[model samples]
Target: MTWKVLLPVGEATEVMDTLYPIFRLPEDGFEVVVAGPEPRLYHGVMHEIPPNENIPWDITREQPAYHVRATEAFRDIRPEEYAGLFLSGGRAPEYLRYDQDLLDITRHFFEAGKPVASVCHGVEIAAAAGCIQGRTMTTVAKCALDVTQFGGIYVDQPVVTDGNLVSARTWHDNTPFLKEFVRLLKASVAPK
Candidate 1:
């Protein structure tokens, strides 16, 4: 059987964080479905602290990059149809946290014990969904509160796996992040 996964995105979704899974998941035969606040094209952005010889910026610099289409709107999603949930990080989650539909979909993955992965600001969505409580995970240092505030334990590391959920600090950790996510997806399925 084909394994389907859901990726939630919004405007300004981090290109690296969002695109990595879009391509990587298919290589392992997991069909990736992108969902957003609406079924439309959303812009992606590059986020990084540009190298500076003098004073360094405290936050990442954002510049527009590519576009990713959301074929499905969050309100239309059927969480049980997916085998996994991947939340890509970006400034999007700052507002997406208020999306009731997205929050509900997020909760389903955790409630069902389906494999879930999150990176950077992606944790905000999960935290808002009330699914992070008591779980150990990692995310960009700035987002550490998203975990602790939601009664989850936060760790500073490349990746953290607690039960069916896997998380990473940022896209830079995608190597180990996606590797572990793929393993979890494959293992969740029974042999034919």
Candidate 2:
């Protein structure tokens, strides 16, 4: 059977974070299903620290015009039908973490012992969904506290794999994270 992976997208979704896996997964034979608060196009953003800029912007203030549309809604997802779940990063997670529907979908993956991968701000979703307790994971430094606050051990590394969950600090780490994540995913679907 073909593998299907759920990618929960949202407004202000980091462009790199959202797109890399979308393209990579399909190349590996996993169906990429884009989901969101609602089934429609959502804005994506490019996040960078302008070299000359010296001020930090609260995510809400750094909005750029990038966006990605979701082909489906979190409320409409059947988590059991997918092999894994991917939570992308950026300002989106700052708000999306509060979404009950998204939380439900997140719980589905963890509760089922499925392969789950998250990067950067994606840790917020796991924290909010209460899935991080006692789990070891990693994310962009700024989000380190979120994981620990939720009772999960936060590691600083390019990539870290704990049981069925795999994570990276940012898109720069995508290469290794995807390498490890795909391996874990394939193992999950391997013939028993």
- Which candidate's TM-score is highest? 1
lDDT of 2 by residue, 84-141 (tens): 9998898899999999999998999999999999999999998899998999899988
- Model 1 Cα displacement at 159 (Å)? 0.4
Give, for candidate 2, the lowest lDDT window spanning 10 residues. 56-65
lDDT of each: 0.94, 0.89
TM-scores, each model vs. reference: 0.97, 0.93
Superposition error at 54 for model 1 (Å)? 3.4
- The lDDT, on a scale of 0 to 1, for candidate 1 is 0.94
- How does model 2 score by TM-score? 0.93
Best of the candidates, lDDT: 1
